[model samples]
Target chain A: MGATFMLGELVGGLRRNLSMAVSVVLVTMISMYLLGLGLLAQRQVDTMKDYWYDRVQVSIFLCVEGSQYAACAGKATTTVQREQLRAQLEQMKPPIKDIFYESQADAFKRFREQFKNSPLADQATERAFADSYRVSLTEAGKYEVVVSTFQGAPGVGRVQDQKQLLDRFFAFMSVVSWGAIALSALMVLCAILLMATTIRQTAFSRRRETGIMRLVGASNGTIQLPFVMETLVSSLLGASLAMGLLWATVRYGVGGYLSKALVDTAFIGVGDVLAVAPWVVGGVTGVAVVTSWFTLRRYLRV
Target chain B: MILFDSVTKTYPKATRPALAEVSLEVERGEFVFIVGTSGSGKSTMLRLAIREERATSGSVLVAGRELRALPDRKVPLLRREIGTVFQDFRLLPGKTVFQNVAFALQVIGKSRSIIRQTVPETLRVVGLDGKEKRYPHELSGGEQQRVAIARAIVNKPAILLADEPTGNLDPATSREIVRLLDRINRSGTTVVMATHDHEIVNEFRKRVIELDEGKLVRDQVGGDYGTTTSAIPVIRLDEAGEPGQAGDPGETGEVR
Candidate 1:
């Protein structure tokens, strides 16, 4: 019976202050959207790292004629020198997981295919490229060992680990992910303050009823439930709206454009969005309900 | 039934106590008036009875429960047994008279059938039978008080505490309100009214408990509203200060 009364009052409170209720809902929606966005961005960063990091290789470029590199000042890579380099890599302690030798012709063919649309492709020739051995390691961090053992070796121009090329980009992405998470946290704080203010206004507006409720022996819980429920309802509505927006973004924004646009690498699918939707619903609703409970405690003295 | 045993309520940083060493009791089904000036602690007496404040010293017992000993959670349960009507008529402006009266029952978790039957009957008793559909603003001052009375009595409380129920009404309406209270009293509920209305006090001739500067100067059966002629010699300090807004009575250690 008390539950019914409170339910009635909750509906009544929402009706009495429609504008404030809408404000709570809107603020909650925006905050929850930001929260979901933060999670999605972190997931995207992890996706990119996994996709790119797993394929990183240590490329050992062999010395070639006319090479200005100091390591190549001795002699151009002979067939015996190339064969000896391969033998040394095969005997590495960790053992190269995979290794492939690319001749200058193979390198030029790949470069032409990569830069097919660029005019730089027409200016490149087979001799313009360098013969190199691409080494795939069991652990990418072992590139330093490969670099020390092979640097300045006979017919070796330079050992370039793919990890270095990707590190700065990954680090920048991490900073962006953290920034997003921090911003989401700040937005949630603002939403809480807005919820608290909205509830306080509703409580203050109906204080006469509350004072009488207190006077006539209505329990504190009875008085507070209505106000708390008002906030919860608004927050729930906001969270639900946020999830819908996220679903739409996943369907059209990510699945429609991002995944297709970044065809060369990997992109998060709708499955990732589906996986995160629950937290958006559960997390924001939890925040709303808990904050509402606390906010009501301060205002519902009656 | 109510009992105040050696209860002295003093506010912090005040020159004098609100109620000084006062002890009084009322039997079941008694109508009593606690009359005093603005700072006479009439409001404080009602606040104490409702357990809004713990007594600074001594105890206030209402309906067989000592307020000081009552746990915080149980205070609401105690209030359920008591009805209170205030000077402002504290009606929910947004609600109709019916909703206002039904609210008391709803808060206590009363059944829908019981609320439906009791609310209308209570409203009828206060001469507000046809005004149930009207909002508080749609009703007159007297009608609003009647709605407040209906809300108070719908729960069928043992004691009805009226703290200046007529303070906002004109004389004619005040008399009408007093008559409604009288009618309620005839129904066997103990009505404790605190008022400064001289005419109603003289006319009703109920038991009057007068407080002059927090001291119970008089407690007599069928007593009239007394003037300064009945006032006892007590220190007058902060005559303009509000006793109702005083500090909590629980802090006995604060008194020096």
Candidate 2:
């Protein structure tokens, strides 16, 4: 019966202050939506890191005809020299997982296929490139070992770790993730203060009823339960709305328009969004409940 | 029953006490009138009885509980046992007449079955049975005071304190309110009414305690309103009959 009375008062109080109540809902929804967006961006960055980092390879390009390295001698090292280098590379402790030797002809074929529609494809030839060993590390961070080993070795002109390039790519994304999280936090603070003030005003308007309740032997919890429930109800409405908006944005707005327009890399997938749904819901509900409890504690005493 | 022992209540930053060393007692089921002019500590006395204001010195006992020693948590329980009717008829404007009366029982955690059964019966006692659904603003002054009365007694508290319950009503309506209060008193609820209305005091001829400048000037049993010189002329002429009339002067005027 006590719970029902409190629930009734909560509903009645919300109805009595419709404009303020709507403001609370809107504030909470918009704040949580921004927060959800930030989380989605962070998730996208993590996924991109995983996808690109796994495929990255450190490539050691062999010397060409005019190269000045001592190991190169007068011309590109012979097939026996390349074969010896490959065996030496594999013999290192905690050995590289696998190495693929691409001949100049194979590299040229890949180049041609990649630039099939470009004018450069017509002028490109196998001799224009070099035979290289594309070394796949067991882990991306092991590129340092491969680079140090092959830097001054025979017939090695240049060592390029694709993981470094991927790191630079994701570095930019980390900045964006941080900025979005910061902005969302600021907006959430504003929304929480707004919610607290709105509830305080609601309590002020009904102070007479509260005073009477206090005099009539109602417990402090009994007096405060209605306002707390009011805040929670408004926050829950806001959180659910925010989740719906986030889902729609990720499905249509981000997935369709943004992803297609800027297809520099793979974006967040629908599976990732589904994975983080509980976190988003839990974060929103927790914020709403906690803010309401603290605000009511300060204002509803007496 | 109520007792005050050398009770003194001084507000912050005020030199003098609102109630200064006042001591009084009323037995159970007795109807006592506390009469004083404005600012003579009448309201403070009632507030002390309800434990709304703690005495700065000494103690107050209400219904056998030490009010001054009661903690904030227990104050509400003390109030539940002592019903208070204010001059403003402090009914919640949002609630219906029935809801206002039912609120007292609701606060005490009475079952819904008991609320439904007792509210109408109590309203009938105050002659507001059929007007249950009307809001306070919809009722006349007299009707509102009656609703306040019904709310006060719904819990069947040990004591009923009315701080000018008829302050807003006309003379005839005021008389009716006093009659209702008297009826409640006869039914065994101790009643302490504070009023400045001299006519009602003399007419009812209940025990009256008078105050002046925060001091108890007179306390008399079966006290008339004319105990003090300034109060004599304020009594109704028809009720007081001939001038300088003494009590129980046999055949002072014709029966007709």
DockQ of each: 0.54, 0.37
RMSD (Å) of each candidate, 1 decimal: 6.8, 5.8
lDDT over C-alpha atoms for residue B125 of model 2:
94
The CAPRI classification for model 2 reads as acceptable
TM-score of chain B of each: 0.88, 0.88
lDDT of 1 at B51: 92
Report the error of model 2 at residue A41, Å: 2.6
lDDT of 1 at A194: 91
Task: Give the Å error, residue A217, model 1.
Answer: 1.4
Candidate 1 docking classification: medium
Model 1 stretches with alpha carbons more than 4 Å out: A2-4, A90-95, A116-128, A141-145, B229-256
Q: A288, model 1: CA deviation in Å?
A: 2.6
Instruction: Give per-residue CA lDDT, model 2, range B1-256, as digits (tens).
Output: 8998888888899777777888899999999999876667889999888877888998999988998788877777787778778777888899999998887777557888899999999999999989999999999999999998898888888899999887777778989999999999999999999986666887899999887767788888888654343443334233333344334343222111
Model 1 TM-score is: 0.89
Clashing pairs in 1: none
